[model samples]
Target: MKIATYNVNGVNGRLPVLLRWLAEAQPDVVCLQELKAPDDKFPEQAIREAGYQAIWHGQKSWNGVAILSRIGAIHETMRGLPDDPTDQQSRYIEAAVNGILIAALYLPNGNPKPGPKFDYKLRWFDRLIDHAETLATSGLPAILAGDFNVVPTERDVYKPERWMDDALFAPEARAAYFRLLEQGWTDALRTCHPTETIYTFWDYFRNAYGRNAGLRLDHILLSPALAERLKEAQVDAQVRGWEKTSDHAPVWVRLRN
Candidate 1:
C-alpha cells in the first residue's frame, strides 16, 4: 500500500495541481492538510472522479484536514483533537482504511515566537503527545501522517542557524516533536534514508526550490505493527515545480500489505 501526505495550501485554488498528482502518483491512501475551505465547499465530486473516497473536517477560510482512500471505505474515527472541545481548528482527522488506522494532522505553525501563537502550538503538541501515547500502546496498525510543522532537527532544514529563531525550529517545538518519537512511532522517511537530505517543503520566496532550499516538514510516522512493513519512503519533489503547485510536495511510504 502506498500511503502519502500533502499540504495542498488551498484545496480549491490548487485543485488542478492536486488532480494531476493524484493521477500520476495514485497513492492508495492520502492525508491532506490546509484545505482552506468549508465542508460545503470541498470539491467532493472532483475527488470522487479521481477514484477516492474522502472525509474532511473543514473550516471556512483557514485550517482544514482530510483523508482520502482508494483502497476501501473510510471509517471515520475522529474529527478533531480531544481534550478541548472548544478549540475549533480543523487540524486533525482520523479514519480507518484498508484495515489500518490513519491520523491526518496539520499542526500549528507557531510563527513569530515568544508570543501567544507559539504558546498555543506548544499546548497543542502536548495534547497530541498525550493521545499518541495511547495509540502507541494500542498495538493497532497505525500511521500518523501529515504536515507536522516542525523542522525536527538541524539536519531537516537547509540552514539550521538561520532558522534557530523561527518557531518551527525552536527548541521547545523540536523537543515536543522528539517526545512524540519517544512513543515508539518510527519516522518512516528518516528511518528509510537516515543520512539523506530529504525535504518536502520549499517557501515561495527567493527562488527557494530552484536553489534547493527546503525543509522536511511533512512526515509519515508508523506504529510498531506497521513499521516492519515499511518498504520505501520518498518525496515527489518535482511536484513542487508544477504550475500553481503547493509549497509542499507529496511524501509517501510504500508498505507491504
Candidate 2:
C-alpha cells in the first residue's frame, strides 16, 4: 500500500493540480491539509470521480484537513482533537482505512512571534503530543501525516539562522515535535533517507523552488508495526512546479502488505 500526505493550500482552487497528481501517484491512501474551504465547499464529487472516498473537516477560508482512500471503506473515527471544546479550527481528521488508523492535520502557522498566535501554536502542539501518545501506544498500525508546520531540526529547513525568530522554527515547537517522535512513532522520510536534504514546501516568493530553498514541513509518521514495512519514501517535487500548484509537494511512502 502507498500512503501520502500533502498540504493542498486550497482544495477547490487547486483541484486540477490535485486530481492530476492523484491520477499520477495513485496512492492507496492520502492525507490532505489546508483545504481553506467550508465543509459544503469541499469538492466531494470531483474526488469521488477520481476514485476516492473521503472524510473532511473544513472551515471558511482557513485551516482544514481530509483523508482520501481508494482501497476500502473509510471508517471515520473523529473530526477534531479531543480536550479542546472551545477550539473550533478545522485542522484535524482521523479515520481507519484498509486496516490502518490514520490522521490528517494542519498545525497552526504561528507568525510574527511572541504573541497569542505563537502561544496558541505551542498549546496546540501540547494537545497533539498528548493525543499522539495514545495513538503511538495503541498497538494498531497507525499513521500521523500532514503539514506539521514545524521545521523539526536545522537540517529540515534551508537557512536555520534566518528562521530563528519564526514560530515554526521556535525551540519549543521543535521540542514538542521531537517529543512526539520519541513516543515510538518513526519519521518515515527521515528514517528512510536520514542524511539527504529533503524538503516538502517552498515559499512562493524569492524563487524558492528554483533556488532549491525549501522546508520539510509535511510529514508521514508511522507506528512501529508499519515502520518495519516502510519500503520507500519520497517527495513528488515536480508537482510543485505545476501551474497554480500548491506550495507543498506530496510526500509518500510505500508499505509492504
Candidate 3:
C-alpha cells in the first residue's frame, strides 16, 4: 500500500492542485492537514469522485485534518487529543482503513517564541506523546502521518542557523520530535533513505521554492509491525511548481504486502 501526507494549506483553494496530484500519484491512503474549512464546507463530492472515502474534522479558517482511503472508508478510531479539554483546535483525527490505524495531525505552529503560543506548542507535544504511548500498547499496526510543523534535525531545513529562533526548529520542538522517534515509531522516510537530505515543505517567502530551500516538516511514522513493511519513501518536489500550489509538496511511502 502507498500512503501520502500533505498539508494542502486550504482544501478549497487547492482543490485543483490536489485533484491533479491525486490522479497522478494515486496513493492508497492520504492524511491531509490544514484544510482551512468548516465541517460543512468540505468538498466531499470532489474527493469522492476521485475514488476515495474520507472522514474529516474541520474548523473555520485555520486548522483541520482528514484521512482519505481508497481501500476502505475510515472507521472512526479517535478524535482530538485526550489531555486538554479546553483545547479547541481541530488538529487531531484518527481512523482505521483496511485494518491499518492512521492518525492525521496538524501540530500547533507555535510562532513568536517566548510567548503563549510557543508554550502551547510544548504542552501540546506532551499530550501527543502521552497519547502515542497509549497507541503503542495496542499492538495493532499503525501510521501517524501529518505536518508536525517541527524540523527534527539540522539537515531537515535549508538554513539551520537562520531558523534557530523559529518555533519549528526550536530546541524544545526538536527534542519533542526526537522523543517520539525514540519511542520506537519508525520515521519511514528516513528509514528508507537514511542519508539523503529529503524535504517536504518550502516557505512562500523569498522565492524559497524556486531555490530548493525547504524543510521536511511533513512525515509518516509507523509502528513496529508496520515498520517492517516500508518499501520506499519519496517527496514530490515537482508539485511545488504547480499553479497556485501550496508551499508544501506531497510526501509518500509505500509498504510491502
Candidate 4:
C-alpha cells in the first residue's frame, strides 16, 4: 500500500493542484495539512469525486488536517492530540485505513525564536512524544505522516549553520525528534536513503526551488510492524514546481501488503 502526506497550504486555493496530483500519483491513502478553511468550507464533494473518502478537522483561515483513503472506509481514531484541552488548533488527526493506523499531524511552525510561539512548539513536542510512546508499543501496523515543521539533522537543511538559530533547527527541537526515533519509529525516507540530502520543502522566495535550496520537513515515520514492511520511500520534489503549489511537496512510503 502506498501512503502519502502533503501540506497543501490552502486546500481551496490549491484544489486544482491537489486533484491533478491525485490523478497522477494515486496513493492509496493521503494525509493533508494546512487546509486553512472552516469545517463547512472544506470542498468535500470535490474530494469525494476524486475517488477518495475523507475526514477532516478544519478551523477558520488557519491550521487544519485531514486523512483520505482510496481503498476502504477511514475509521477515525482521534481528531486532535490529547492532553491539551485549551489548545484548539486543528493540527492532528488519526484514522485506520486499509488495516493500517495512520496519524496525520501538522506540528507548530514555531517561527521567530525565543518567544511564546517557540515555547509552544517545544511543549507540543513533549505532548506528542508522550502519546507516541503508546502508539509505538501498540503492536499494530502504524505510520506517523505529515509536516513535522522540523529539520531533524544538519543534513536535513540546505545550510545548517545559517539555520542554527531558527526554531525548526534549534537544538531542543532536533533533540525532541531524536527522542521520537528512540521510541522505535523509523524515519522512513532517511532509513531508505541514509546518506542522500533529500528534501521536501522549499521557500518560494529567492528562487529556492530552482536552486535546490530546501528542507526535509515533511516525513513518514513507521512503527516496527509497518517499518518491517517498508519497501520504498520518496519525496515528489517536482510537485513543488507546479503552478500555485504549496511550498511543501508530497512525501510518501510504500509498504508490502
Clash pairs detected, candidate 1: none
Off by over 4 Å in 4: none
- Model 2 — TM-score against the truth? 0.99
Q: Which stretches of model 1 miss by more than 4 angstroms?
A: none
Instruction: Tell me the tens digit of each residue's lDDT in model 3 across 172-250.
Output: 9999988888888999888887888888998899989888899999989998778888889999989998999999999
Worst 10 residues of 4 by lDDT: 159-168
Stretches of model 3 off by over 4 angstroms after superposition: none
Q: Write the per-residue lDDT of candidate 2 for residues 153-203, one digit (tens) a residue.
A: 999999889999999899998999999999999999999999999999999
lDDT of each: 0.95, 0.94, 0.92, 0.94
lDDT of 1 by residue, 127-169 (tens): 9999888888999999999999999888899988899899999
In candidate 2, which residue ranges exceed 4 Å CA deviation? none
Each prediction's number of clashing residue pairs: 0, 0, 0, 0
lDDT of 1: 0.95
lDDT of model 3, residue 5: 93
lDDT ranking of the models: 1, 4, 2, 3
Q: Is candidate 1 or candidate 3 better by lDDT?
A: 1
